[model samples]
Target: MSGYGVVIPAFNAATTIAETLRSVVAQSVKPDAVIVVDDGSTDDMAAVINALNLKVRLLRQENTGPGSATTRGIAALSTPFIATLDADDLWLPTKIEEQLAHFRRFPQVAGVFTHWRNFHHDRPDAPEAVTVPGWSRSTMMIRREVFDAVGPIVDPPGGRGEMIDWIARAREAGLVLDMLNEALTLRRIRPGSLSYGRDAARDRGYLEVARLAMQRRARNRTEPS
Candidate 1:
C-alpha cells in the first residue's frame, strides 16, 4: 500500500480552515499524514485545528510567506508522495486516489494535477460553478524525488508567483506533470485570500519569477549532460 502526506500552509484562515480540514478528512483515500504550518496568523488557527480532533501535526513560526511555510511542511513529512491544499480550498474525495493511480500507471511522470472549479461567493444567482482549465497549486500531488531534482518552490516576495515559478522550474528540469483532465479541487473566490487582488508589486513579482525561471533553464542547458 502507498500513501501520500498532505501539506497545507495557512495564514489567517480561521474562517475556512475547518471546512478545508473536513474536506481532506473526508477524502476517499485518506492521507497517511497531514501537516499544517501556521504562518503567524492572529486568528485562532490553532484552536480550529485542536477542535477538529484530527490527527494533524501543527507547526508554528513567525509571519513567513506561504512559500516558506510550505517548505517547512514538506520538510516535516517523510511520505513518498506529497500533496498540497490551500487553506481556503476544498479537495474532492477522489483527488488523491485518482492521482496516485495515474502515478502507478505512468511511473515516469513527476506529478499529477487537475483543472479547478472556481466557486464565487459574491453572486448567489451566478452559475453553480465555473471551470478553469490549467494547473493549480492545490490540485497537485508531486513525487518527492522531483522536488529534490528541481528544488523547492521559489516563492516570490509577495508569495503570488510561487506556483508559477515552481512549474516553470519543473519543466526546465525535465519533470513531467500529468494533467488528470478533471477538476479535482474547488477554489473559493472570497476576500482575504492571497489569490485575491492585483497590484504593481504582484505584477513585478510575476516578472521576477519568469526571469528567474528563464535563468534556470539557460543554466540547465549549459550544464554537462
Candidate 2:
C-alpha cells in the first residue's frame, strides 16, 4: 500500500467517468486504491466502469446526494491519505505527485490542493489548461485523520453545496490547509451537470448552505472554549 487512495462520488456520470478514471490511473504517483460510489446512477455507469477493466472498487446505493456518496467512499478507503475527484473531472499526469510533494514540504498542513482550469466536456482538446482558482473537491488531498475529525460531509436538501459546508466545517476545526499555484486538474463544464443550470433547487441549496454555515458560526461563538 502506498498509503494513498482516491474516493470518487458519481451520479449518472457514464459519459465521462472512464476518461476521469484514466486520468487517475495515469497519475505519476498512482493511488494505491480507488473507490467509486454510484449514487443511484440511472445511466450505464457501472457497466462503463467495468468495461474499462480499471483498478476500481464500485459500490452502489440509493439516490443519495454527492455528500453521502463521498462519505461512503471515504469510509471504504483504508489509506492514511485520501484524494477526491469528481467523476467528470480530469487531472494532469503529475497531479497526485505534485500534491504529495506539497504534503511532504508542508507537513503541518492538513491538506494540499492545486489550481485548476475549466474545460468544456465536448471540446476537451481545446482547453487552454491551468487557470485561476482551485480548492475544489476534485483538487483536495488530505490525511484520513482530518476526515474523521471533520465527520461526514453534510448533504443539504437541494444537494449542491455539501462540499462547501464540509470545507467550512474543516476550517472551523482549525485544520491548516494549503493550495499550490500550479493548475493540475481540469474541471469539465457540461450543460446537463448538476451545477450547470440555475434553477429553484440549486438556489435553495445555496441558501441552505449559507444558512447552515451561519448557524455553525453562531454555535461556535457560543461554545465555551
Candidate 3:
C-alpha cells in the first residue's frame, strides 16, 4: 500500500486527544505514520498522549497556532500524502481507505475533501452533515507536494479562516479539488469551540476567504491576452 501520513495538531485537548488517536490507530487503511503536534498546551495533553501508548510521532512547540503546528507536522512527514484531523475530531475506520482509493482513481486530483457530520459533544443524536462549497479544509486529504508548491497553511488573521485561505490558494494554483461526498470524519461541537461563540468573527473570516478567492479568480481571468 502506498503510504500516507496523518497530522493531528492539538492544544489544550486532553479531554479528546485519546479518542482522536484511537480513531486514527483503528483506520482500515492505516497511516504510514501518525504525528501529533502539541501546540503549547498548558494542560496535561502531553500526558494523555503518553498514556495512550499509540505509535505516533510526537512534536512539541510553543503556542504558534494550528497552521504553524500543521506546517511543522507536514515538514516532518516522509510520506507522499498527508491528512489532517483536529484533536476534537475523528475519522471513521474507512476514511483513509476510501480517500486513498479516490486519490488513486483520480490521479490529477491534488486534494480531496469529504463531507462531515457535526455533533454536540454530549448529544447522541445523529450528526448534522454540513454541505460545504468547493474546496474546504474541514474535511481534506492532500498530496504532500501540493503543500510544497502552494506554501504553508497561512494564519488568516484569526479563527478557522486559514483553512479557507489554504484551499483557495490550492484552487488558484490549478489544483483539482474534489469532494468524496461521504461522511469520513466527525467534527465535534463543544461549548468553547471557536466556532461556537464567535459568530461575528466567523462570518468575517468567511468573507475574508471569499474576497481572497474572488481576487484569485479575477487575477486568473486578466492574466492572459
Candidate 4:
C-alpha cells in the first residue's frame, strides 16, 4: 500500500466537519486524496466544504444512509488502501502513519484497526477516553482487494450495521485482520449522531447481521470441505 485515500461520509455536519478535516490535514502521513460524500445534507455542509477550499473532493448524492454514502465514496477512489472517517470524528496525527507502518510489518493482513477514544462534543476539557475493543469503519485502513473479496458494504435498512456486517463477513472469508491496540481515532459523541443513541430499527439491523453470520457459520460447518 504505497498510497491511501480517505472517504468521509457526511450529512448535515456543517458544525463539526472543519475539525474533522483539520485532523486529516494534519496527519503525519498525508492522504493521497480525500473524498467527502455529501449525503444530501439539508444543512450547509456543502458550503462549508467549499468554503474551506482544501485539497479535497466533494461528491453529492441523494439522501442515502451513511453506509451507502461511504460505499459511494469508496467506489470513486482508486487508491490501493482506503480509510473511512465520519465527518464528526478526528484522527490523531499518526493515525494513518502508524497503520501504514503496521501494514508494512504484516503485509499479509488485509485490514488494520486501532483502538479509539470517545469524547462528547461539549466536553473537551476532560474527555473520557476508552479503548474500543471491536473494529469500526473510522478506525480501519483496509486494502481495496478486501472489498472485492468481501463484496460491497451491507447497507442496513435504517443504517448503522454496515461496518459490523462487513467485518463479520470478512472474518468468515478468512481474511487476516490485525489490530494495533492504540487509540488513534477520536469518535465524537453528539446529539442526533447515529452512534449516539439506540434505535429499534438500528438494533434490529445489528441483530440481523449477527443472525446471518451465525447462519453462515452453521452452513459452513455442515458443508463437505
TM-scores, all candidates, are 0.92, 0.95, 0.89, 0.94
lDDT of 3: 0.81
lDDT of 1 by residue, 1-225 (tens): 478899999999888899889999999999999999999999998998999999999999898688788888999989999999889888888988899889999989998998788776454323346666557679989998887787776568666888888887788767898888778888888876778777777667788897887787788789899
Q: Which candidate's TM-score is highest?
A: 2
Query: Of the pair 2 and 3, which is ahead by TM-score?
Result: 2
Worst 10 residues of 2 by lDDT: 124-133
Alpha carbon lDDT at 128, candidate 2: 64
Question: Which residues of candidate 2, in runs, are more than 4 Å off?
Answer: 125-130
lDDT of 2 by residue, 1-225 (tens): 246999999999999999999999999887899999999999999999999999899999999788899999999988989999999999999988887887887888898888898888778544566587676789999999999999998788777888888888889889998889888898888997877768786668778989988898899899899
Local distance difference test, each candidate: 0.84, 0.88, 0.81, 0.88
What is candidate 3's lDDT per residue for 1-225, written digit by digit as tens? 479999988889999899889989998888899999998889998888999888888899998778888889999998998999888887888988888899989899988888777777887527455643324444678998999998987655555677878877887778898888777778788987655666775567667778878888898799986
Cα distance off (Å), candidate 2, residue 198: 2.0
After superposition, the stretches of candidate 4 with alpha carbons farther than 4 Å from their true spots are: 125-128
After aligning candidate 3 to the native by TM-score, how far in Å is the CA of 71 from where it should be? 1.0
